[model samples]
Target: MPLSREKIAATAIRLADAHGLDGLSLRKIAKELGVGPMRLYDYVTNRSELLDLMVDVVYARIADVGQHSEWRSTVLTIAQATREAALEHEWFADLLGGRPHLGPHALAVGEANAAALSEAPAVRGIDDLQRALGALNAFIIGAVRREVTERRTARSAGTDEAAFQASLGPYLTGMLKTGRYPTIARLVIDGAHLNAEETFNHNLALVLDGITSRPRT
Candidate 1:
């Protein structure tokens, strides 16, 4: 088959899924595609371009939340969809927020998010919209990274989240006993350990609330 950008990006994504970004290279993708590495350069200019293409391939999977009557709902839908995509492509979290995504699919996703927030009643102007999107992006990226890290940790530990937590229970308990961190001790004693989805939704709502509640200037 003739080499194409799509083919190159797809092979790169598959390699990344298995070996992660560090394992991904033009040579590896070329090997996977049964072509010389130099041939890939014909399609992708360089490693950076390859990464951009890989990121866009993943972004293409995210469904548009579309414009909705309630801006919050639209924002929430977009956030959820993004999280889902990142979870599916664990490498996505590493690339996300690292640089601007100018690909068509990435721009479509951004456009949807911007449109939703722009129509928000509390959004005073461009500044408000920028801040709101910035906040959402920060939360989404952080949350996804945390979740992905935990997943990798759990897998590496050869245990589930509960087992891993249990393994840490002794050390954590001992640290909490220090009394130097009173609030943290209290949280250890009383805080609910929400699952990843619950934690994401709960925190996302809080973020959205903060954005809407900000005073219009």
Candidate 2:
């Protein structure tokens, strides 16, 4: 049977995760699918279309997530899902710009997040959706970019995150301890043991705090 579009798009997503956006090409996809490069052209016109399809596939995974009564919960679900997607396809970091419009996955994820803001009692009216969606997209994108950038920098330094920090600890610690940046030093000392999960949770809570602590009257 000829491959369905869903099959093609799903394959593209796995390819993006395995090889990133740069390494993905019609030839590469064809190889993975056990076909000729021309076979892909039958379904997708070019590499850009493939990337768009791959992103939409990810959107499909999280599309049905945020439809409940609480808007904050919706955003949290979106935040986690987007982070997972970004980490899976670290190359997406380089490919997300210049979008003509949000694809299915991106739009579905946005709808989930928008559901969260929709539940907020104070965040009513038409413009509120825009504010909520903007805040959520910014937060998720920022979190993933910081995370991937740190991982890339660590790789460039020829070490993982913990080891890189250890290698630089002496100099950085000294600068902190000597009162160059006392607050930074204290947080580093106090936060040295916090893992990625803890860090993400903390950041999520901080964002939620900002949303919740606002003047609701």
Candidate 3:
């Protein structure tokens, strides 16, 4: 019997999550598995190959849509999956921007999104689908980046976002009381209902507003 690719990928993911991608190496993975460095190459040829496999391993978790029956739902689900991918490996976003067109995970995600968006009623041509996919990917990637960075920052500072924001909420409330920034105050006071889901929805709808608004033949 041979070492399973799943076992090798898991070791790499665990190592990347713990030490960041910068420190991830074949030797490190082998050390984690209690095997020689040469043993890893039997499953994956090199670090590049290992990265591709690792990416697909993460992407394999995404839900395969039968169709884009609900565009909003698909986008939101993918967005949430993006966040999950980033959180699963702290170094994911760090590796994301640079490893395009090469990693298995990277291409798998693109294929998934392209297939989903291509089925949308609003998509008219290949060009339309391509542009929409580009915009959607950009919007989602930005959302995940913002979330993971903020969460990492908050955690490193010994607090989570809610507690940190709560400390400032009172100050914001006082500013509202004195009317220093009346419009902002009003929004803040009323925006207390704004949670993560709501915020993401607001941004998602805003982006898709253009898509939904496009002249349909």
Candidate 4:
């Protein structure tokens, strides 16, 4: 059977999800697909192009942001969907925002997000809507990246976040006793919410509140 770009991208996504981005390569993908490594070039020019395709394929999975009735809902939905995708594909958080993904699906998602914001009563013009979208994207990507990174670190350490933090307790105690970082020390001593989902939702709500509360200029 002949290979198509979509098939190539899909296979790459699976490989990435299974082995992580660092473990993914054309050679491995071709081996998994039962094809020659050189044959992949017929579809994607190189690794960079293949990476771009994978990013788009992942972005395509996000439900249309404009489908929601309200801008706030749409933004929240998109943010949640993005976080879900990143969690499902651990490599996704790293690749996101690393490059411009101008693929069809990516562009469509962008359009949907912008359109949803444009319809918001608070958004006065194209500029405001664009800024709102940008701010939302920035927050989602940053938050998810941190979440994914911590998860990955915990996995590597052969424990969950709470256990990992517990392992660091001695060092943290010493550092806190110095009183060099009072706020961080307070958070550590007072205990903070370690639940990724709750943290994401809480921060997302704060971001949305900021966006909506901004006075229309």
Candidate 5:
């Protein structure tokens, strides 16, 4: 009921979700909370701090992939959970990888991941662990960005995935007929049409495998 940092972040997130980050302002959050804009500064210093709080709130939603039987499974679970959270909070994808998240909740997620990987035989030291985590984070962030962008494109065009592809069919057909892009043509014609979830899982498994299979340094 009372104003709090969490409440402010939550309101900002909700506003961002409904509209977008471009127009998210402290004034909007204050009005949403039925308070004056200056009052919001008591909880959040500025837009940057507000963004940090929003990201932390989203990270808090990530399910704890606590202590799995194997490090790979732990990493996989965490990655999947992160992706799920980002998808739910679409603005999260845009903010992710933009800055270091040192908030309690964000640190907890990172700590849980580091602890699990540290116990693994493949993780020789801090460097290896950092590398592994970095790789996963990079992939997850990039993948989420791409997926959300596609979703936005479809929404803006008022078309579903299938229809969107159909709309591009004519241009693609002409490009493919040139015979200069044999490999790309083959991919467009034969690539597996995995849904977003399947596509993410499939690529994620490959990334995990690559990470674990690297020679111990």
Candidate 6:
């Protein structure tokens, strides 16, 4: 059968997951699909359009979270799902926010998030709902980008975070001795559990709290 846009996007997603965004290319995807590079043009005009399709495919995975009646829970669920998807496909972190996503699945996810937030009594108007949704999405994208960066750094260093920090212990100790960065030193010595999920949840709650605590005007 001739290749379809969905098939091309699926293959591109797999390539991105395995090789990261920097490794994705029309030629590479064509090679993986056993087709000439020109063949892909029939489905997607170019790499930019292909990326849009891939993003929609990823968004489709979380498009149903808006079905919940509780707005806060719906937002949290979608945020967590986005984080998990970013973890699975690190390339996704780079594409997000790079361009507008108007594909069906992307629109569906947006509609779900908007609908859930719109139902909240705390959300007073369209402006408030838009702000809340924007804040939630901004937080998720920023948090996931940092997480993906850290994970990539660890992978490059061939060690987990604790081990990676241990490797830097001597250097960090020397730097700390200067007492030039007291706050960072204090955090390094006194911070609680540095769990990614725990940290993500804590910060996510903080963002939600801000949204929910806002006085209705």
Q: Candidate 5, overall lDDT? A: 0.84
Best of the candidates, lDDT: 1
Off by over 4 Å in 1: none
Predicted candidate 6 versus true structure: per-residue lDDT over 62-171, tens digit per residue: 77554666777887798888888888888989978777889998888888788877776668888999898889889888999999998888889999867877888899
Of the candidates numbered 4 and 5, which has the greater lDDT value?
A: 4
The C-alpha TM-scores of every prediction are 0.94, 0.82, 0.76, 0.92, 0.93, 0.93
Ranking by lDDT: 1, 6, 4, 5, 3, 2
lDDT of 3 at 155: 79
The runs of at least 3 residues in candidate 2 whose Cα sits more than 4 Å from the true structure, single-residue gaps closed, are: 64-66, 93-101, 156-158, 173-179
Q: Write the per-residue lDDT of candidate 5 for residues 114-199, one digit (tens) a residue.
A: 88767656678889888878887888999989998888898899998778878999999999999999999989999866699888
Q: How many pairs of residues collide in each model? A: 0, 2, 0, 0, 0, 0
Candidate 1 has an lDDT of 0.87
Question: In candidate 4, what are the lDDT values of residues 93-201, reduced to their tens digit?
Answer: 9988878889888888887788877876667887888788788888888999998998888989999988987899999899889979999987988876567898889
**In candidate 6, what residue range of length 10 has the lowest lDDT sum?**
62-71
Instruction: For model 2, state the Cα shift of residue 179 in Å.
Output: 4.5
Question: Which residue pairs clash in candidate 4?
Answer: none
What C-alpha lDDT do the candidate models reach, one value each?
0.87, 0.72, 0.73, 0.85, 0.84, 0.86
Off by over 4 Å in 4: 64-66
lDDT at residue 143 of model 5 (Cα atoms): 95
Q: Considering only N, C-alpha and C atoms within 3 Å, which residue pairs clash in candidate 2?
A: 59-105, 71-116
Q: What is the lDDT, from 0 to 100, of the residue 158 in candidate 2?
A: 96
Candidate 1 TM-score over all chains jointly: 0.94
Query: Candidate order by TM-score, highest to lowest?
Result: 1, 5, 6, 4, 2, 3
Worst 10 residues of 2 by lDDT: 92-101
Off by over 4 Å in 6: none
